[model samples]
Target chain A: MEIYNYMGYELIEKIRSKEITIQEVIQQTYERIEETEELLHSFVYLSKERALKRAKNLDAQLKNGKTTGKVLGLPIGVKDLICIKDSPTTCGSKILEEYRPPYNATVIDYLIEREGAISVGRTNMDEFAMGSSTENSSYGPTYNPWDLERVPGGSSGGSSSCVASGQTPISLGSDTGGSIRCPAAYCGIVGIKPTYGRVSRYGLVSYANSLDQIGPLGRCVYDVALILEIIAGYDPLDSTTVDIGVDEYTKELNRSIEKKTLGIPKEFFGEGLQKDVKEKVKKSINKLEGLGANVVDLSFPHLEYTIPTYYLIAMSEASSNLERYDGLRYGKMSDDLKGDVYEVFSRTRGERFGSEVRRRIILGTYTLSAGYYDMFYIKALKVRTLIKKDFQNAFEQCDAIVCPTMPTTAFKIGELVDDPLQMYLMDVLTCPVNLAGLPGLSIPCDYDNKGLPIGFQIIGNYFDEKTILNIGYQLEQELNIYRKIPPLTIRGN
Target chain B: MSKKEELSKETIEHISKLALLDLTEEEKEKLSKQLGDILNYFKKLDDLDTTNVKPTTHPIDGLKNVFREDIPGESLSNEEATKNAQHKKDGYFKAPRILKE
Candidate 1:
């Protein structure tokens, strides 16, 4: 029997009941990987032997009555940008072709060592977690399982694709200005980018430090909530992590959405939104209203400046953070090591870093350079202040803000690759959440005429993940769409 | 908005040098135009008067000086440290000479 087809919650019940062994789940997961990997290309590496051995050990422990953490026997696909000690954490860039982290990220320890969730393997991502589409990956673009020719949304695209296609029950994804949420929205699954500093960033590779956050993507909101509970909390290793404490997210999932006020940012629904996406989101808002949630339409004046503020600040930090790859200690250094230090650094980076990576680095360097520093980088930071205030003001009147995750549904693969500005525009509604360091949830709300999923984004106040989650949980119960698997999963099988 | 800022080829070369990236003419040409366009759009910020707005480098307010006890901790060992390096000499990473011989 294909026990892997079950959700994490169901799989846990069955594992506890001894109805199915962990080995059977592992076998079926590998069977699915073997079946779908060719067309989907969701994974960069598969820990087949290790997972098989681990499964046997877990099954033996269950028989021996040994303790297992929550989500025991569940399989998780981790994005390549996160470190998995001794595994190839590629960040989907050839610069780190042979690189393996010596120590597990704090999140990996929580998921694998502490929590007992099994690692299916490292998944793919954008090079250095830069792009919105997984096409920026040196491994090549991951196909959207919903539509073969379309993209799986990116940076965290592989993580989203794996769960949507049912290769793993849940996966880890990092969001630095919508990396996690964008792909989650595009792929038709549940993903959460928690309030900044909520999840420890110790093991996740840095792209933009101030904005980078580690989060989870899952087949449903409950699974995403489950992983968040496991991975969140303070860690001395990551000082940015707060000691604010994690709530019983799964338990709170049943909370009613009545009396909760949701803000509809008028600017989010303005000019660029596609007609179908707008209609579906408005209809979902009506559904929330029908469920007794109060809806308020408010104007967010500074919304137009989000892309510029997000891109400028993010790229500037990314440029500074990425200076570590000198080719001597990590990744594949350029072959022309015979030159002096400067030449070696230039040559190695020039040869190894992808086009998008290099472009951002140069632009970032310019932003921080003399004469332009105040006019560009500092101005972006000040604008970040204004944008952050915009969220603060909105949250004062609402429990959560609801909007379309993307201006449109998933586009064809390679559609916006050459046009960087057009591609950056894809994060229009999503990046503002990151700028404010607030929690954002992308849930599959409705499907367009093409059967492509449209995501409804819920932005909540700092550390108020529960309210947004309760809203998502209530909506999910109302919609009953979590069990709808993508056609590619079935077709490939 | 700031007279439509543009990046010249010389500026790209200079910044590329500072960024330690060697770029071909094609990349230089492309980045010059693309980065120019992006910077121009960023001029939109000037529209809002951020006169007294303090720059927010970190998102969470009131988090500062997260100091801990002054002590050593478990970390990557020497062998593990250089495990992914392509070249090594006597437990140290071997890199090209820093200065011209």
Candidate 2:
């Protein structure tokens, strides 16, 4: 039987039934990783010994009849930005080439301790999760599993690619302005960006702290829901995390989406969206309506300003959050400094961070600088208040907002490399959700004539993750469109 | 386009210096051009009716500060602190000799 076709629940049941061993599953996972990793470049770091040891322990526990969690023995891929104990948390940058954390992130702890999930490896990402494309990684860009010449959408590109390719059934990814969903969309998988504070950010290397959130990516909606259950919760280490009660996400999967309302915001489908993406998303919306969802035309007038507002606020937060990576503290040190403390600091930073990171830092610093503060940073904050208010108004009228996850599908790796602004604009549709701190999900809606998968985005009110996933599940049953398999380049079988 | 926000090489150097990044002359020139282009684009917003539009800082609901207990908590020991340091001496990192003659 193709056990990989099953959801987290069935996969766990098979392990318990003696039909499969965690060791066998993990070996399959590693074999797949080894097969596809060269083309996908999904991983920044892989721990063969650690993963095998964990698998062996899980197998022993199963043999002893000690199954204790939902994701028993499932192998998961982790984005590099989230720290895993003793693993190199490079954040896709060369500066932290040797930096290893003394502790696991709260999510890592949750996945390993509370839930018995084995980690396959750390996935590659954009440097500091700054860019929309995985091409910005200092290690090298991870290619889309669907097409080797194309990018796996980023900065969670690696996570999405690994999941899509079946290297792992599920993976953890962080979303700040479409990092998770965009890549998931491009790679033809399900990706969710939970409401801000829904998942603890304690051990996540900060990108845009306030907007950044940790979520999951999978080939299907059920797996996405199960993984979210494992990782979502409050952590005392992170004050930003809310102390919310965890829900049985898998149970919500069975909830019917008969009478739920889905709002299709007009502004999102405006110009600049590729025609192929529009058709796929529109057809999916119509299908959901056919399946009993009350599809309504909605207006989020401020949607056009989402990208600019997101950039200002995100860059500002990124500027401050990344300030701690001075060579004197962590990361690579510079040897060319000949004078004072200032020289040491400058030389170290210049040599360490990539051009993209430095550009953002400079832009952020300038915006927050003495004279520009009131005009830029403070102004952007006020706009953020308005953006959040827009979501609030929309949620009052509907249960969820549906849109395209990205303006277009994944492009050639070098297509937008020289034009950062164009790359930044690719995150237009999804950034607003991060700005509003709302829950959002991206699911494969259809494959275009060219055979590339297009994703439809569904967003919900704060803490309304269940509604979005239910809608996604219902739509999945109707469309039965899950074509984002890792191409032969990355699939071991 | 008016070049009001044009960044000079010296200014780029100054920003780089402030940012603690070492840049070769070639990189500085390239970054200067790129930064100039980006700033020029954002300059369009300066022409908008943003006088009434508030700048967005964060996208979350409410703004209440949550504070931790004042009780003392576990701290990292010096051994643990210096365990990963590439350079250290006498419980401190040793830098270049810096006594002015």
Candidate 3:
């Protein structure tokens, strides 16, 4: 059996039952990585030695009849933005190319200590989780496994691509405005952006503090739920985390969503949406309606303002959060420069940061600057409240909302890179969920004529991830769209 | 498109300086045009009357200042903290001199 092709949950069960040694799984994971890494360019760093060592130790523990933790030796890929102690956490930028964290992220601690999962490698991403396409990575763009010339949606493109190509059955990605869902949609995988603060951001390199979240990507909703169950909860280290008890997400995966009301926000289906994508998503919503769900036409009047509101707020926060990278502590530092402190600051930042990062910083600085504060920053914030209220009002009549994850399927690499506005619009459908701090799940609904995958997004009320996961799980069982491996993975074997 | 409003080169330079970013002459020209386009697009917000709405700085509602007990816990040693530093002196990060002699 090709163990790499098994879902994360199945692999764990197999290891727990002693059907396969943990070493065998680890070996197969690396072999799969080797098979597809050249084409996909999914990972920035691979911890083969560490993963092998941990697998061997876990194998010994199992033989000694010791009870392993929940995951029981499942290998997971982590987005490079999340720090793992002593591992390179580049966040896909040249600025911190050699920087390693002194401490692991709270999620990494939970995965290793509480759940017994091994992080196989650091997946590639947009520099500091900034762009829609992985094209912004200083390392290079991660290609979609479906078609090498096309991009894997980003900034979590590497995480989604790794899972889709069978390199790892599960991985973690951050969503700060559709980073997680976009990649999952384009790569034909399942990804969840849990409620903001549902997972700790202590180790996540912040792009925008208020909008960022760490979540899971997997081959199926069940696998995504399992990882979410292990990672979701409050952490004292992150004061923003809500002090609420985490529900057993996996327990509710098989629950029925019968008689539930799903609101299809009419604004999302309007102009610029691809015909094929719109049709596919509508069919999925219809499937839910057939499953005893009441589909209602809901309007979020503030939908058009989401891109500007989200970008203004996110960029403003990012400017503040990124002030720490001044080259004085932990990152690339310049030498042989004869300049004062201010000159050093400008030179270091200008040399190290990429064009996108510099652009956002300047824009953010201008918005928050003296003469324009109220006209730009404050106005954007007020519109943000209106956007949030739109969701609140819509949720009053529905259990969840549905939309196409992206307006269209993944485009060819470099197709939209030059046009930043076109690139920003790619997140139009996904960013509203982040703007309101709600939970969103992206699942493969159908494939386009080019064999590229189309994703359907389910947006749930704040802290209501279970309901959406339940809805996704039911649809997943019926659609069974995730069963097809990307042609690259099949060819590799 | 009617005459679009543009951000001046002076404003871009000032903002870049505030952001501690040094832009090349070419980058400044390119960025000024891009920023002008983006900000012009954002002018759509002017259409809404937000007089009664309160700005939302944080997404979560009803969050107050979280106070933790003043307790000591494990902390990073100086060496561990400075391990990634490119320039360090006497357990401190060495930065370019701020005061000119």
Better of 1 and 2 by DockQ: 1
Q: lDDT score, residue A386, model 2?
A: 69
Q: What share of the true interface contacts does candidate 2 keep?
A: 0.43
Show model 2 residue runs off by greater than 4 Å: A1-6, A335-338, A489-493, B1-4, B44-56, B96-101
Measured against the native two-chain assembly using Cα atoms, what DockQ does each of the candidate structures obtain, in the order listed?
0.87, 0.49, 0.83
Off by over 4 Å in 3: A489-493, B1-4
Quote model 1's iRMS. Answer: 0.9
Reference interface contacts recovered per candidate: 0.89, 0.43, 0.83
Candidate 3 per-residue lDDT over residues A74-142, each given as its tens digit: 999999999999999999988897999999999999988677899999999999999988999999899
lDDT of 2 by residue, A1-493 (tens): 4545565566777887879898988887788788768878899889889989988988888788776766888888899989887788899997787788877899988987678988888899999998887998999999887778888899999998888887888899999999999999998999999988899998899988889999999888988888888788877888877787978877887787788888877999999999989987898889888888787787887776666678877887877787777665456667675777666667777777888898888878767777777766776666667677778888888899999998888788899888888888898899888888899999988876666779899998888798899889888888886643555442221
In model 1, which regions exceed 4 Å deviation?
A489-493
| Native-referenced Cα lDDT, model 3 | 0.90
Model 1 Cα displacement at A324 (Å)? Answer: 0.2
Q: Which of 1 and 2 is ahead in TM-score?
A: 1
- Report lDDT per candidate: 0.88, 0.81, 0.90
Model 1 over residues A1-493: C-alpha lDDT tens digits? 4654677788878877888888888889889989888988999889999988988998888889895778778888999988988888888988889888998999989988887888988888889999988898988888888987888998898999999988998899999888888888888999999999999999888999899999999878888888898999999899999889799898998877889999998999999898999999999898999999998888898999999999999989989999998878988987666679999889999998999999999989988989889988998899999999888889889999999999999888777988999999888898988898999999999898888889999999999888888899888888888888888832221
